[model samples]
Each structure stands twice: as C-alpha cells, then as structure tokens.
Target: MSEVPLPSLEVDVPPEGLSIGETARATGLSVDTLRYYERAGLLLDPAPRDGGGRRRYGSADLAWIAGLVMLRETGMGIGDVRRMAELSRTAGTEASRLAVLEQHRERVLADLARTRAHLAALDAKISSYRHAVAEKENA
Candidate 1:
C-alpha cells in the first residue's frame, strides 16, 4: 500500500499568534485537551489571552505542546509529563529532567525487547507450520 503523507505539525506562528482552535489543529489535540492542559498546569506559562479573553498560542507554545504529544504517545504517564513540564519552568532542573527521560528510555527499551521476543516466537511457530505442510505435501 502507498504511504499517505501526513501534514506537518511544525507550524510557523504569525505575529498575531494562533487561536485555541488553530492551536488544537496544529497540535493534533482537541480543544478540550487544551483547556485541560491549562487547568492541569502542564504549560510552562499560562496561555496568553486576546482582548476578548480568547486563548492565543504562540510558536513556543506549539513547540512545547509537540513535545508533550510525543511523550504521551510513547506511554509516559500524565503525572510524569506534568512533572517534566513543571521542571521546565524552573531554573537549574536540567538534571531532574534528564533523569525522567532516562527512566522512560529504559522502559521503552525493555518494551521493545519484549516485543521482539514475541515476534521471534511467532516466526518460529510459522516456520514449524510451513515445514509440516511441506512434509505432508511430499507424502
């Protein structure tokens, strides 16, 4: 099957910034998720508000959210993600952030190894079935 090209998530923000809906589209998150992020204190800085009190997201906000999406997709829990976000806002927390990522890396590596083992078992079973069928055909 041909692979379909996906739209780029990296968006260039204009001077005016993006509205909540625009940000949601750019980040591949729902509008409700954006509001939840605000209430959950996952953002480094509060979202800026326009004259009418609508949320406005700038380039930095989009970049940060992209990272959050990646982390979540990789199976990082919400609490850990929130911790990383909190660490980002403070000064001299680089080591803490590194520790969090390193821990997640280890977990991902373990999962990959387990999945590979399962794949190997499946391959061996398929090979045995194919051999049996070939012998039967010869008979």
Candidate 2:
C-alpha cells in the first residue's frame, strides 16, 4: 500500500496572528487543550490577548505549543514538560534540557529495539506457517 502523507504541523506566520480557533486548527489541538495550557502554565506565558481581549496566538506561541504536544505525545509526563518549560524560562539551563531529552531518547530507542525484535519473531513464525501450508498443498 502507498503511504498517505500526514498533514504538516508546521505553523506559518500569520501577520495578524492567529485566534484560538485558528491556532487549534494549525496545531491539530482542541481549543480546550489550548485553554488548559494557559491554566496549567505549560507555555512560555498565557498567550497574549488581542485588541478585543480575545486570545491571539503568535507564530512563536504556536511553535512552542506544537513542541509541547510532541513531548507529551512522545510519552513525557505533564510534570516533566512543566519542568522543561521552567528550564526554558531561565538562563543556563541548556544542559538540564539536554539531559532530559537524552534520557527520553534512550527510552525511545530501547522501545524501538524491543518492537523490532518482536516483529522479527512474528515474521519468522509467519514464514514457517507459509512453508508448512505450501508443503501440505504439494502433498
């Protein structure tokens, strides 16, 4: 089967900035999630408001939120993401951030190796079954 391309999560700069709904669409997150980020302090700061006092999301904000989504979806706990956000807010925290990410990367690579091993075992079993079926057909 041909692989279907997934939509890009990359946020383009909107000169006027994006409204909450537009930000949700661009990031594939719900408005509720965006609001939760505000309440949870997961972002750099609560997204700034526009002239009318509605939340206006800048491109930078969208990019940051997308990263948060990636981290959380990649099995990072909310608390860890919060810690990383705090680190980002301070200066000279690069090494801490790298350590956190390096740890997560190691976990991911280990999981990948385990999954590949399982897949190989399953493939071998499937080949054995196919050969058995072929022999029965010949008989």
Candidate 3:
C-alpha cells in the first residue's frame, strides 16, 4: 500500500490554540492520555489561558505531542522521553540531545533485527505450508 501522509501538525492546531478536547480530537488521543502526558512531563508548559484557566494548546504543542506519540510507538520509555523533553527545554544542548538520540537509535536497530528474524521464521513456515499443500495436490 502507498504511504499515507500524516496530517500537518502545523495546520491542525489553530494559532489561538485549542482546548483539551480539541487537541484530543485532532490527535486521536483520549483526554485522559493527554492529561497523563502532561502529568508525566512529556509535554512542555501549555499556553496561559483566560478565566476558568483552561489549558490551551498551540501548533507547536501539537507537533511536540505528535513526536511524543511517534517516540512511544517506536518503543521509547516514558521516563526516557520525559528526560528528552526536559533536555529540549534547555538551550545549546545539541551534543546531549544527539547522545540520547543515538542511544535510542541503537535500541531501535536491535529491535528491528529481532523483528526481521521473527518475520523470516514466519515466512519460512508459510513456504513450508505452501509446499505441503502442493505435494498433497500432486499425490
């Protein structure tokens, strides 16, 4: 199947910022998960708000949340992601960020190798099944 491009994070979030419910709807994440991310420090500080003090999320915030989702899906630990988020808040820390990213890349590579091996094993089993079926038909 052709790759489906993800919606532009920049476009989905409004300049004025969206409420928690809006963000959840845009990101396909639940309100509870968004709150959990905030509590986990995975998100940077949201924009300040008016009376009633509702959290407002801008485009940048949505972009960051999308990145967090990608990281989590790629097997990054929440603690590590939280640390990365803290590091992002610091300026002039390219070297530190690179180190963390490199470590994560290594882990992902290892995981990919294991996954490929399992897929190969499954493929072999499938081939065996096909051959067995063919032999039964011939006999």
Candidate 4:
C-alpha cells in the first residue's frame, strides 16, 4: 500500500490570531467544541483575546488542538489527554511525556491487534456465508 504523508507542520504557524469563529471555520470544528476542549483541559495554553477581549487562537494553538483531536481519534481518554497537556506545560523535561506516550502506544498496539483478529474472524464468517449461499443457489 502507498504510504500517506503525515500532515505538514505549516499549520503550526498562525500569523494573526483568529477569533473563535474564525478558528472554527479554519479547523472545521465547532465553536462549542473548541470551548468544550478548553473546559476539558485539553488545550495547552489559554487562548488569547482580541482588543475587545474575545478569545483568539493562533497557529500554535491550532496545532496543539489538532494533536488533541488525533489523540481523541486514537481512543485516548480525556483525563489521560489532560494529564499529557499538564506534562506539556513543563517544556524542559520529556521523561514524563515519553512515559505517557509509551503507555498509550502500548494500548493502541494491543487494540489494533485485537481489531485485526476480529476482522479476520469476520472475514471467515463472510466466506462461510458466501459458500452457503452458493450451495443454496445451486440446489
């Protein structure tokens, strides 16, 4: 199978901070979900504010949120993701970060193995069904 390239880091640079509405439009996420992520402690830094004090998100903020979205898609728990975010706040050391990632990686590997096994079983069942259907049609 052809390898799919990972998303580029270019999204990491947001020049002019975007309002919540603009960010929602850019990321294809809802404003309510953005607020929910903030409330859930999934965001690394507090979103900045415009002159009028409305929440504004920059490229770095979007990058971090995209990472959170990836973790969620991978079936990571919100609480664990929050813990990872807390670890990220201390940028110097990466031991804690590595530990968290290693643990999650193990979990993901195990889940993937199980999913593949289930898929194999389903394929076998499907083959059996097809054989039975063929026999019925021949009769």
Q: Each candidate's lDDT (Cα)?
A: 0.85, 0.82, 0.81, 0.80
What lDDT score is found at residue 120 in candidate 2? 100
Off by over 4 Å in 2: 1-9, 132-139
Distance from true position, residue 52, model 1, in Å?
0.8
Question: How would you encode candidate 1's per-residue C-alpha lDDT over 16-103 as one tens digit per residue?
Answer: 7999999998998999999998889887678999999999998778878888888888888889989998988877887898899899
lDDT of 4 by residue, 1-139 (tens): 2321223234444566778987777677899999998988789888987788899887778778778877788888988899988988876547787788799999999999999999999999999999999999999
Models 1 onward score TM values of: 0.81, 0.79, 0.86, 0.85
Worst 10 residues of 4 by lDDT: 1-10
RMSD of 4: 5.2
lDDT of 3 by residue, 1-139 (tens): 2322333564555566899888888888899999999988888564457467998888778878888887788899998898888987877765786788799999999999999999999999999999999999999
Which model, 1 or 4, shows the larger TM-score?
A: 4
- lDDT value, residue 87 of candidate 1: 88
Name the best candidate (by lDDT): 1
Q: Between the candidate structures 1 and 2, which one is better when assessed by TM-score? A: 1
